[model samples]
Target: MAETSLEQIRSRVDADWNRIVELLKSKIALRSVSAEGITGDHMKRSAQFVADELRKVGVDAKVVQSANPDGTPGAWEVIGSRIVAPGAPTVLLYAHHDVQPVPDPTAWNTDPFVGTEIDGRLYGRGSADDGGGIAIHSGALAALGDELNVNVKVFIEGEEEMGSPSFIPFIEAHRDEFKSDVIIVADSGNWSADIPSLTTSLRGNTCVDVHVKVLDHPVHSGQYGGPILDANTIAAMLISSLYDANGDLAVPGIESQEPVGGLQRDLDESTVRADAGVIDSYTLAGTGSLAARMWTKPSLTVIGFDAHPVEGSFNVISPETTFRLSLRTAPGQRPEQAQEALAGFLESHAPFGAQVRVDRLENGMGWAMDPNAVATKDALEAMREAFGIEPINKGEGGSIPFIPELQRLFPDAQVLVTGPEDPKANAHSPNESISLSGLRHNVETEALLLAKLGR
Candidate 1:
């Protein structure tokens, strides 16, 4: 694609790998967890760190905060760019500096904030999910420096962990600034540490809060327990109905799409079980190949719920109980449609005449990639050279809602979803990590893709 051969790019990545890891390690040390009711300047710190790093690569980088829907201050974001040539195609490199909250440090074998090196991997919160994404872009830019043929832009958002609440407003307000011909979303993981993949499809995600009421106030269990079921009992019944006996989503009007080209990307059952830490006695649910059940099919999860703590024994029946449902939509369905279908199901399936009310929490859109797109072909070739093997197309059951929104905003832009994460990265959980070699490969891949596209 250019005078800089794959061997030369590999040499550059290897030479600078240590410094890139240090950059990501510093980022992981910054607790940039994006969630509501959180009070701290860590988000700003994360944004500033990304901006400062971008400037080192000759980008006019800055920390930006978008206005909320009510005109209030919103989440932090990092924006930067470098114009190589006037006629060169503009490429937007995407990543998020924010990371998911680590609810329990006790679950980790090492410090969640320290990027620890162990067995050829770097372990810490934000190390893989999007922190690795940031490193990929930074490393690519550093590797290519002045010879980068494409006009490059980098946008690192802060609230991805909060479902990107201000993403639309943030982008809409700066339409021209973010406009590009190709968008590289380095937020997804490869198929495996040894196998590279081009993410072809992703499920959109939506959530609903369900409130169930059976009585006016807490009643004595001795007096009311015999006559009627408690609100918690009723809530359990409603939650139970969310899935069929086989465990597929039982909500109405929701549908699944066959993988593009109708060829399935199946996962090994043993590996799936291992990855999930599934108990040996627990039976796997649903139907079809493991990959379809994961990537193409809808799944329902009870993410949040509130009853009473078991430690405190109370002989009273709860008057009401509230629970939250998280639904991952199939690729073809929109977040709104899935939310509506789920809300309708919960409202209609109340048990024993219990009053049920459903409220929308949040949602994000999903996307499918065009396999034949010129950019996709270029990316595959780049990945093949970097990984030294033919890359495979894979779909993630996890949702990256901002991606579909980007497609909607820039209809003419060709989007490429590539990243440094591997299957065992354990993003959003304790002991999250990124593969060292894989990270270097991704940096090489991005540099190569941009080099090829510009040519």
Candidate 2:
């Protein structure tokens, strides 16, 4: 908050940027994919790698394997801490070490596990989604070195990509370890590589697998095509029922309205189109500003399907089909409420008396931060000082399920969600990346925030 009295921290981050990049590359080299059955020993090794890295910077770090709901020892989580004084306010830093499963590694321009620096961007699977987050905290801490003042605690969970299945139990078992005056979730993105942003709200999320059954067995298309609709066609009809002609959600109980708050910043249409990779001539859906459409409004997407492939010639009509829907909720709406409304609408809209069932329901709550919170002010000042530009405020369309839980667990702590990602990061997709300058500024911003809090 003071006039760049912490300029030394920024200089230090700049000096150590290359070393920080190397650390991040080492992290990206580990394939810690934690998606369901694909999880393996790489997760444990990744956690240990992060722990060892933290310890090297003078933080006390260790690895813990928490159990899932089924009572099996689950993924690894890294917990690290450093104490300056008993009187200093404690700050908890959060990031995930696990990455999403690479659907097709061959689709990447380089190896998904290798961090590639091209045109000033570091590209890799985990390079941005969270690997940059760990680098941000580590870079700041290393720069501060003997100047560090506040007590610091770090939680790097390995199951975030799998919706953090065991995070709640893990937190419940180690609650005291995370008690702090401030919490920084470094898992969100900036407005752009040039403009820094603070995520003021995050959309909640729900997912379900729907089964549409039209017949007991597959039938010949030539014989049954006249009167009966195949399960695939019927399933499409049911999904289309969820949206109106304008592409807004049509469910009755699900709320969809323009936001009246949250500093919904202006986003250029061309930038949105380019960032989302929307094809030319394809109009954007929903109403209101692009920011609100993404962050405050509800959206439904068919994430996966179980239909037949076109490779083999099929003269038969499929009798049954299953699809997965990922629904994002508005700020105030609960994931359960949205899932219920969606389920009801789907069952009622079953085409031609087809049997419809919604199964495998999963949900995570959303969150909104006060624009005038003290910690937000501190962070904004930190960003301004680091980037030398007025930072923008935005909300995340994606869900970090564990953030709301951390809020519920520590009601008094100020939670600041900021990170090194930008619109071009393309996290969770192939070719994910973070700009080198953005990463460096983020490290400076974090260091300034810590220094301000210490003061």
Candidate 3:
């Protein structure tokens, strides 16, 4: 497509391979975990690190800061640009510098903050999620150098792991800077290690914390348990009502979309069981095709419950119970619609006239890309050529709010989602890691995509 040959690009990536790993390791060691008790300093440093790296690839980069959703504080957003092809379409590469927090450090085999390489996998928090993402983008740019076919704009967000509460505002402030004909989100995963994938759909997300109070004060369970309804029991009933006998979402009026891309009807149960660490005794929930259930249909999960701990041995039948419900909406379902439907279901299904308070926490819209769109077509061809295999068009169950937001902001731009994460990556879990070979292939794919699209 350009003067650079595929072999030359591959050699460049191979030669500077250690540098890419080192950069990712440095990022992982920075402790840029999503703002738990940590301040914005680490994320700021991480953004600066990305900016500096981009600058090394013949681009000028800068760090931008803003507020979080609560207006307390937010992470940094690193941006940079290089105009290799003067009049060619500008391609925006997106990756996040932030990462999910390690729930328990003791559970990890290695220090989650330190990037450790073992068995060709880089282990650490953020190493795969977006740190590997940052490396992929930078590695691609390094391969192209100043001869890139398209004008390049790199955006490494700092609050992705925190659900990107400040993302829309950041985009609003930098409207012109984010302008582009194509936007590639380097934050999703491939189908497998050797098999590449193009994420064509992402599930939307909506959640609420439901608190049910049965009595104003605690009552002796031994004396009055049978006569009064316990908040815990009512909460359990409400949660059970969320699904029908077949384990499908029982919420009325919730929307769902048919599966796209001729993807497989059902996901391999054996693969899921192995990857998810499901026990042999555990039964798979939900009805219908697994892929449809995962990527194109609504699913409800009771993430947490707050009640008197059994360890305390408090026989209190009275008081309150709270539970958090995480809902994954189908690709075409509107966020507002899903939220309204869920809220209505909970409000109407309060057990035995119990007081039910459903507090909506967050809702993000899902996105779907036209598989036959010009940009999507170009990406498929590039991936096939780069990976030497026909790429699989897949749908992801997770939500990336920025996808829909970016689509709204850049109506004409083609937004492509690709990354190095495989199902075995175990992102957000203890012992998270990335495949070195997969990372290299992803880098090759992006570099080739840029060249092909520009040409």
Among all windows of 10 consecutive residues in model 3, the one with the lowest summed lDDT is: 34-43
Per-residue CA lDDT of candidate 2, range 1-455, in tens?
Answer: 24235678867877887889998999999888887342468888999999998998878999999889788888899998999899998999999999888999888888888899999999998999899999999998898887788899999989888877888888888988999999999999788888888888888989999999998999999988969899999999998888889888889888764543545467799988887788999998877777788887888899999988989869888899999999988877888998898888888889899999988588999888766778889999989988888988888888888898999999999989998799888888889988999999899889889888888
User: Where does candidate 2 stray beyond 4 Å?
Assistant: 1-4, 36-39, 257-260
Q: List the residue pairs that clash in candidate 3.
A: none
Highest TM-score model number? 3
TM-score between model 3 and native? 0.96
TM-score of each: 0.95, 0.95, 0.96
Cα RMSD for candidates in order: 1.9, 2.1, 1.7
The Cα error of candidate 3 at residue 51, in Å, is 1.0
- The better candidate by lDDT, 1 or 3, is 1
Model 3 over residues 85-185: C-alpha lDDT tens digits? 66888999899888888879999999999999899899999888988889998898899876688898888888787788788877887888889999999
Pairs of residues clashing in candidate 2: none
Q: Roughly what TM-score does model 2 have, to 2 decimal places?
A: 0.95
Give the local distance difference test score of model 2. Answer: 0.87
